[model samples]
Target: MNSSLLKNIKTLFKDTFSAEPVIIASPGRINIIGEHTDYNEGFVLPAAIDKGIIAAIGKSEGPDCTAIAIDLKESYRFSLKEVVPVKNGGWRNYVLGVVAEIRNCGKEPGNFSLVFGGDIPSGSGLSSSAALENSLVFGLNELFDLGLSRQEMILISQKAEHHFVGVKCGIMDQFASMFGQKDKALLLDCRDLSSEAFPIDFGDYEILLINSNVKHQLNDSAYNERRAVCEKVAAILNKEALRDVTHEDLLAIEDRISQANLQKCSYVIEENERVLKAVEAIRNNDIKTLGELLFASHHGMQHLYKITCEELDFLVEKARENPYVAGARMMGGGFGGCTINLVKKDKLESYKKLISESYKQQFRKECSFYHVHLSDGTHMIQTTE
Candidate 1:
């Protein structure tokens, strides 16, 4: 956890709770390589980062659920019996969504007082919302003896975001938040919901995230549009998602799709192959090959997917130009967000300084950067002091 965020959580608890409340944490995630492949039922390599949402929660006597955000300094209350959507700036939608989803699933919703905060930079492609939702649902699941397994909880949290929060995301964010393992990245098959863990064996190297600080609200619509286009192509070819199509299949009927849609379909198909190759590289400890795959993925995203922006493209290019960087690519929904890069461990500081100076000179905006570690997923702890 970020020390500042930890200090704030401690101060909030000291000021508000006469008794120590139960503490629960769920980690945010960084997609090390895969981009936009989750919805296409392709493979993704993601790890839960050290940064995440931490919640201090306690049961309430009444039927009303109350939650306060230490970071935003905002408090919200809702009736457990009558859950209604907040009209504006409802950052609490993630929490409310979970409650509504659990209730809809024929489960009883309970009341609680929750105080939460996180160090995960919002809009940095780190899945902060998923961390928040997963933490809250996990806390509630334990507090109420809901008897839900990890996968069940993941699905519930994902459903909450899709139905209540209104973002059509796949299960990846929730799965990583709930099931991440330290020093390993998860290879998730978005099609069958099957996954395997792969050790991140880049010796003497570390992952770094450089936030562009430009929030891309258009991501939601663009994501849906791309998904629609893929679906259209799939329908024309009489298949499911692009995952069903092989590279040869794509080549054979490449002209059946429009130029733009063909590019999209090809990226998804080739990206799936890249992901498999990345897995092999990791298993064989071939850092150089893995790095090349990262660069190739970014090129596909920039030229084919057309989701990458100038700033993100610039960051990737800058990182690639540096001899110390193994690989770099724009992560998450991405009109703008973060570029996930692997930098040589011994040269991390120098690499950061170089990138920051160059990025600032070119973009005229200082970039926010974080060194992240693969971390354990969600867990609950009872605090007694």
Candidate 2:
């Protein structure tokens, strides 16, 4: 947690409730590659970053829970007796769903009051929602002596997003937030929910995220449609999921599946293979190969999956022009978000300047940039005394 942010929330808690609250910092996440593959039960490479949500929480003396969302400046109250999900709860649903899932785990955290906020840029595709959900569960688990293991907490957090918040997101975000270790990236097998940590060593280079700042409302419905299309292709190929379909298999069945469906399923198949290749490239210290895979991944999303927007494409092309930029590609669930890039440390400043200038020239709006490093996942810490 940022010292200032902690002090603020802590001060708010003490002033409002006349008690000290346990502080929690739950980090948002970034996926290097493997976009749109999580729900399809494939591989993903992600890591938790320093940017995230922090909270000051304490149980009330009674059964009524209250929360203060400092960022939104919204305060909410509810009875623990009626911890069920509420449809119109808006952002509160993320918290209430965690409570509901915890109850299903046979542990109710009792009544609580919390003051929370974070520096994670919302809707930048850094998994801020997951960070918020994880922070609530982690704080509550600690507050009530729930004894929830990291893995169990991860599942509960995911269930919160799915069952309560009503966004059927995959497990990658919560897992990355709770299990990430500093200076390492997780190669997660979504099919089995297993992950392996690979050291993150971008020697003489840095990973930068350039935000487009444009989000289309079409993202949610488009996401569901793409998932359904993948499922349809998998059924036609007599596979459990699209992950089981190989490039050759996809080619053979091209005549059977429609052109559009062929495009979507093929992107998943190729993208999954590319994720493994990127893993291998990391192992071999083959930055060039890794860069190639990044570009290929972008092409798949643009030409095949059809997700990239013009702003994202322009920023990537600018990166491609620079010799020191090893790779750059659109990150997250596309339509609009950030492009993760590998820039030579010495050239990082110049790279940013060039991209920013041209991006402003083309889009007539300033794009945002984030410099993030991997950090340890969700865990409670003592607030500064």
Candidate 3:
């Protein structure tokens, strides 16, 4: 939790709305492992990070609800009666989607004023959108006494992304953002929406993120294409999802599908297995094995999934060369984003300098670095008068 961001939101809300506000802190998330496997109903290991969005919201007197985006330096207004998604709505859609989904659930929430901003960098793969959606849904639940359970709130957040943002994202982001706990990573089963939290005790090591600061054009199209391939293969194998297909089952149909499609299916199956092993490794306090799995996961993502960009590959390779880094892999929907690394606390500065310089020289663009702490999920800070 950032005190400065909270202070800024309070000041912004008071100056704009002239009423007491209910404050919510909704955190962005980082997946420790299990990339590109959630839609397949495979396992994912994710934890909420300290970086997130803090929002101040209050019930207003009319049908029109006004919102101010403190970071974007913009304002928007909409009517509660007409809660349709706007074309190219950007952030507004997230707010509108939450309200729209609430109404869809047979609840009538009145108009409200809102002001929000966050420190989570866009396209850094920290799941800022999920954080924003959860913040609004959680805030509205509080203001209206919506009686929404945390699970219900996360589902609402997921639907908001699907219906309004036009992104067919899996439930991992919203689930992690809503259910995350401090010093723990969740081994989430996408099929059942159940998770086992593993306490992260990386004694002398820490979580580090190195952002490539580049989003390749292939990200969106490639994601859809890969997902379709997974679905197609699952249907061919007479399974509900790729999660149900074993390694031998994949091999049995290898002669039927293209080598490319085989690789994609193999990656999902293998990544799912790796996630299970990762949980056991955590349980036994085996950080080295965990780090090795990170490297292997990156190899599959790079070669089989083909979602990684040169910038991302370069960063992960650099991390591989450093003895201090236990494990590193490109996280989120690849093509460009951060590589999650576990580095020895002592070498944090030197590793950052080496990677930053090498990345800049190779790509001629500056990359960013973040040190993140595991944090709790979205919840109320206070209602200030």
Compared with the true structure, what per-residue lDDT tens digits does model 2 show for residues 181-297? 998999999999889997978777789999988763322547768888888888888999988888788889888878988888889988999999999998888888888888889
lDDT of 3 by residue, 1-385 (tens): 7898899999989988889899999999999999989999999999999999999999998669999999999999998778898988889998999999988888888889999999999888898899999999999999999999999988888889878877767889999999999989999999999998878898788999999997533224578788889999999999999999998998898889999999999999999999999989988889999999999999999999888889989988998998999999999977887999999999999988998888889989899999999999999995452
Backbone clashes in model 1:
0
Query: Best candidate, lDDT-wise?
Result: 3
Backbone Cα, N, C clashes tallied per candidate = 0, 0, 0
For candidate 1, give the lDDT: 0.83
The residue-by-residue lDDT of candidate 1 on 291-360, one tens digit each, is 9999999999999989989999999999888999999988988788899888999998888888889989
Looking at candidate 3, the ten consecutive residues that score lowest on lDDT are 215-224
lDDT score at residue 260, model 2, on the 0-100 scale: 84
Residue 194 error, candidate 1, Å: 2.0
Best by TM-score: 3
lDDT of 3: 0.90
Ranking the candidates on TM-score from highest down gives 3, 2, 1
| Per-residue error (Å), model 2, residue 292 | 1.4
lDDT (CA) per prediction: 0.83, 0.87, 0.90
Off by over 4 Å in 1: 2-7, 10-20, 218-221, 251-256
